[model samples]
Target chain A: MVDDEADLAEAIGKALRREGYAVDVVHTASEALEITVYTPYDLISLDLTLPDGDGRTICRTIRAEHEHQPRILMLTARDDIEERVAGLDDGADDYLVKPFALPELFARVRTLLRRDADVAIGAELEIAGLRLDTAAHRVVWKEAEIDLTAKEFSLLRFFMTNADDVHSQEQLLEHVWDAAADPFTNTVRVTVGTLRRKLTAATGLQWIETVIGAGYRFVKEPVPG
Target chain B: MGRIRLPSFAETIRFRLSLAFAVVVFAVGAAAIAGVFLYENSTLVEPVIMAEKKIVRDLATGELTEVSVIFPEESQRVMAEKVELDAYRRALNSLRTSSFLALGILFLAAFGSGWFLSGWALKPVRSMTAVAQGITGSDLGRRIGMTGPRDEMRDMGDTFDSMLDRLEVAFDDQRRFVAEASHELRNPLAVARTNLELALQGGDDEEIRTAAAIAYDAATRMSGMVDELLDQARESLPVNASETVDLGDLARSVVQDFRASARQRGLRLEVRADPVEVTGDRLALRRAAVNLVSNAIRLAPEHSTVTVSVAKAEDGRAQLAVEDVGPGLTPDQRTRVFDRFWQGEGQEGRGAGLGLAIVKRIAERHGGTAEVVPAGDGSRFVITI
Candidate 1:
């Protein structure tokens, strides 16, 4: 979340964090750009006006520089049609006017993320016999429903979306954790460990496997037996 | 589709001017020609005497002597002069007919030239009308910009352009004021809304408390902004300015009201009053005094005195002023001190910035003036009626 209004930015950041999304808040365009240089966000909530620079220019810079362009959701106090159209024309995926309800903002963020990950809205992610309903944040192993914390659910969602790929701890931190997380910490490993235990305990099979020298990957399917 | 109708010719200035021209020209020409014809006719009717040389027999002389005789015979002289009179009468009748004929032709020629000349002369007015009609509140930049030798019509066009210049500036200021007001309103509104949403989302007690506090602050800010907006609107309204308001009483009341607030800020409220009366709206005058005192209290340093004074000026006008010993305004700030939404340096988020502007409006509505009085130690504001 990027906004010159510090209070609004913090509130939105807290709400997004509660929704199981790792959210970082910044009050200026300079800080927003500085953070984006290191972290590859899937979607960005951008306020149209910032202290250091205009949000549209920041949006354009992000679009031009970032190899993996984050989906930008513009938040502006101006509700004029021309501003909205210009925002979208400048590469904003969506926009919300100021004084918008939290639920509406959350919905837009979720939609943008889903679109970014190429996941169907409200669709359940299934790999082998493990099924995850992203919208409800529910996990099901065969017929038994599994409960997960917000962080664990987010990690599982990321894994299920990229079912057969290896992601390093640093890579996981960049995508799954906000910028506030320590780079040299073991949080990502611990989270992956806990997530693995939960999946194994429920299905009697190890879903996440760590290669000898590579990062962990989620298996697309378990052995037939 | 509606039927097209042409403009009425008689109603146009061109047609009216042309008709007047034709009438004047025809009248003058006919009068001069008729005078000349009348004089010629009067001279032509008189009989001319003739002398004839003829052989006549002298009664007293037997021999016939040749003699010139004057024709005194009335019948023969009438016969001889009758042909000349007839010719002169024929020439006078032709002169009368042809003089009138020339006058009639001159009237037609004058009317045609007058119509064209009037139309040519009104071209600038037509352009000015077109330019005026094209202007609206949203689009104010169009100018007549008449380029010609300075004349009445050109002068009018230049005056119109200058008026539009002033109007455009005023309109731009109004638009900027509205935009700033909305922006100000939106900030607090967004803060309150987001915080309330967070608080209602069933967070922990500490988080909820924080959100509630932030939301409360936002609500207060928004209410303050709304109050200032309301005050501005009310001050701008036309009110009866015939009431005899005592300036001293108004200042004393304002000082009394702000006494506690001023003390809380560690500022002293001093009122020096002499009975002075001004004709204006009592409520508006009181509001202006209150605004000045409150601003002084807000800006003055701790332990400083804020003097509220009301008295009759040397010029016999009533004056009410508030002076504070704090940071004095710069030269630039002093000039724009009463402009809408103008805040002091380093006081970005102080108030809505409409208090001084409202005071100025009230002063003007009462046929008075509000001004910033320069001081060595601090700043002062005065309203004179």
Candidate 2:
């Protein structure tokens, strides 16, 4: 559990610990990033507005560094649809607004954990000509090995899971960052462009399509070899 | 004897009522004068004629010489002349006195009748004026009661009452909307604050980063909800200006945007158009179309299809239809599908339940209507403009 409020962080940590999950509480975004390098957490709860940097950037950094990312649930008081969409787009598994019932928070946390467990167990997911081997963390295009960074791999994995779907930048951030980040940040685009370049260089095919005024899409449209 | 105000109570009533009263009085007074004039003329002329007859009778009988002849004292001839003169004078005096009295009485009666009748007739108008004065912005609900027989006043009161009813309902809805909006907004603000407070307290880099991530997500969702609500509110208002909008293009664009979200859920979103056009506000119409498409995306099941088609109906009205291969609504659900906060059973997680209601309001604003009908094993929403 991480929050600027000591009381809230402590309270949330105790609640999680009571539920049989080991919990660690952090205060600032910068400190939270530092701790992730040493501790392997099962789940993370994030708030968007922070004293240091925004939570979205932290989500991006986490996705970039972590091998097995923890399940993330965003807690916020913002009830706007765009914010919710942006949170989901950022890479957060789920979101709960502030003043929310504790039972609801617990339920969402459980749901994310269950989903993370399922994702951990699933070995491979295939879409069109693209294949992702979760166990190996590798991508193959028509049996050709494609080298990718951790962020690229995660982005590709998210796209494959939701193939032919247009995701807004905010949505990409939410999914990539565990929905605990700012969607307004352009980090998703830079990362996507980089990932697209790598994928294109390796496979000589532009698999990821940009849907203008929307986000990005992974359609099965074949590029000329 | 006090200084009277110009157009005092009596004068105002007299001005309004005196015309008809004066006409009646004049006709009656003229007839009375004519009758009295005729009666006095006959009475005075008859006595004079009787005296003339007595004199003529004496003269014809040669009872006395023409001049200086001894005439009998108190004779019928001598007496007839003297009485004739007195009778003429008395008749003139009596006629003048009675005519003056009659005129005076008629004038007084006319003024009194005019004042009383005008006051009686204007009572309803005065009450109406009072009610009108009370119907300000803060007191729009008050209505004037007719309080009389079924006539023009009743019609006026009924009309006023109906107008007040509509205004009251409109004001009440506005208040409820504002309250709901404020309540919804409070949630996100609280979350953002909590996140900021936690970030400042100092934690491990990972924990801090995670907290930051969660906070960002919350802020984004809150902003989106607020934007959507504001957009809906704006579109629901009646457009003050109108322009020709290409319904086909608008429908296609909205669908194109949602295509990806639909595909992600394994749902196919298709748009078909026939170059339909309508006169309306472009932004408002687009919002309405987007709302419908969004709703379809939410309601359609995974691995199903949502189709949006725009065309002209047989009646030359522009029509747009969004069809989804999802569980359709029941009869009861369809009845209030467009009512605010009307959520169907099993639709708790779908949305805020304001989509259809906003769409309906927009449609009405544009002189159009939205209806949900069963279509192809699911539901189809048709908007005609």
Candidate 3:
């Protein structure tokens, strides 16, 4: 975690370390850049405003220097819209505005860390007779191979990976779709609907359940017909 | 909207002009008539004077008798002299009549032309006034664009245009300062909110939790209400350290800050940015963009996404936009959204309703504007700076 405020930084570091993850706290932008250059850490919690330099520059420089970059989660006291956009553009994978809850911060860190470890963790996923091969970009349901668009494939993988957890259209867009995907577009909804219909047609089971105004949840149990 | 009054006799340039013309023509006509009358009178009297002088000489020499015949035709000379005198009297009367008639004609002609000529000469002034009248408080961007010979009226038009330009800038600066002031105050509140919420989590004991809740409520009250009041009281901040800023970069950074809150609420905050440059106070621009995006996220439904886009508008302006897929604003809502201290229906505790106003102000400072346009099932709030 990188922050200029010592007290806040220490608090965040303690909270993060309590989650059984090794954490290092740094004060200045220079120290942040130095540590990331030497150590190949799994994740970095970066502050936007620092003592020596700004956070966005540090994020960009680190991204350029490190070939296999750590998952960068920007921590900024500035919670305005454009600042957040700049942090993401500066190459941070995720961001948390200051005054954020420790649990919420941890959830984001965990999410980013899981993504970092995603490719290495497994090549195949099996849930409720539906199998997904992460490396091959393939899915099989009830002994039948299913055709999927790249986005649909990723959407299915995300749903399967975070089974029983609800996913919003926005979360799906961020995770499954490309960076250029417009958030205002209904593509996420349309793709999810198509993917669900296709999966149900293949196996006669609805794996993804709509939670209405909340979001979509991946059902662990069989469809309650 | 005040009515354009017909120029009263006292105020109209037309009247003043025509009066001046009429007075000059009348004076010159009176002088000419008097001079001609005097010359004619002198000529007529000169002949009479010569005859009278002859009679006086004859009387003195005893050659003239009142009732004596002086020749073969007794009354011939006397009758001839009487006829000559009568002819002079008729000529003098005719001259007097013609002199008055000439004066009347000239005066009428002078007044007619004076009315039309003044209108023609002041044509530029009238048009310049029309342009000025059209400028309302709602729209200050219009310029006279006056084109004409370089004269007094043109100079006036140019001066008015320059005045409007300065006024627009001054209004813009005032707006930017107001926006920045609110954000400056709110920053600490936002930070306090997070720290309080964090403190609340650490205490699982009921008493401690109660204490934390009180503190959280106090912060919320302070931030959501009191802070706004204080900000309004302070009104404006110093001129933001103006600099050349990358608008796209600034927008992206604000989105990064909202990412966590968006995630926690099951909403996704995403950004589409291009490297667009502009000269402005970076801090103020960021605050404006932040307000817009914050409004979007607050209004957007769960499972929906709030998208921020930064690019160059068609007019070569740096643009930042935040789109929400929530309930689109009503016509009334859209109109009133920028009004200071106005809250929407059911917007009791969210904010002090200064967000959009600040956005508008910031945009103005950058020589641009902020607007909300209806889209799909929501609204797109755009700031072109």
Per-model chain B TM-scores are: 0.69, 0.63, 0.45
Better of 1 and 3 by lDDT: 1
TM-scores (chain A) of the candidates: 0.91, 0.51, 0.53
> How does candidate 3 score on lDDT?
0.73
**Which regions in candidate 2 have their CA more than 4 angstroms from the true location?**
A1-225, B1-98, B126-148, B189-246, B256-268, B276-283, B297-305, B311-318, B325-337, B342-353, B364-369, B373-379
Give the better candidate number (1 or 2) by DockQ. Answer: 1
Error of 2 at A80 (Å): 23
User: Model 2's CAPRI class?
Assistant: incorrect
Q: Model 3, DockQ value?
A: 0.08
Model 3, runs deviating above 4 Å: A1-225, B1-11, B38-105, B120-176, B193-385
* TM-score of each model, paired residue for residue: 0.69, 0.47, 0.37
Clashing pairs in 1: none
List model 2 lDDT by residue over B1-385, tens digit each.
9886665644664465775786688678978788877786776542222211222235567674333333354366556876886878787888789887878778778867876877777777788879888887656878886776888867877788788889988887786776566645554455555455545555568766766776776677567667768776776566966888899999888988998888887888888998987888887788788888888787788889888999888889889999997788878778989987555654423344577888888788888899999886789999998
What are the fnat scores of the candidates, in the order listed? Answer: 0.61, 0.20, 0.20
Report lDDT per candidate: 0.84, 0.72, 0.73
Can you write out model 1's per-residue Cα lDDT over B84-137, one digit (the tens) per residue?
889888988887888878998999999999999999999999999999999999
**Per-prediction CA RMSD (Å):** 7.4, 22.9, 22.3
lDDT of 1 at A5: 75
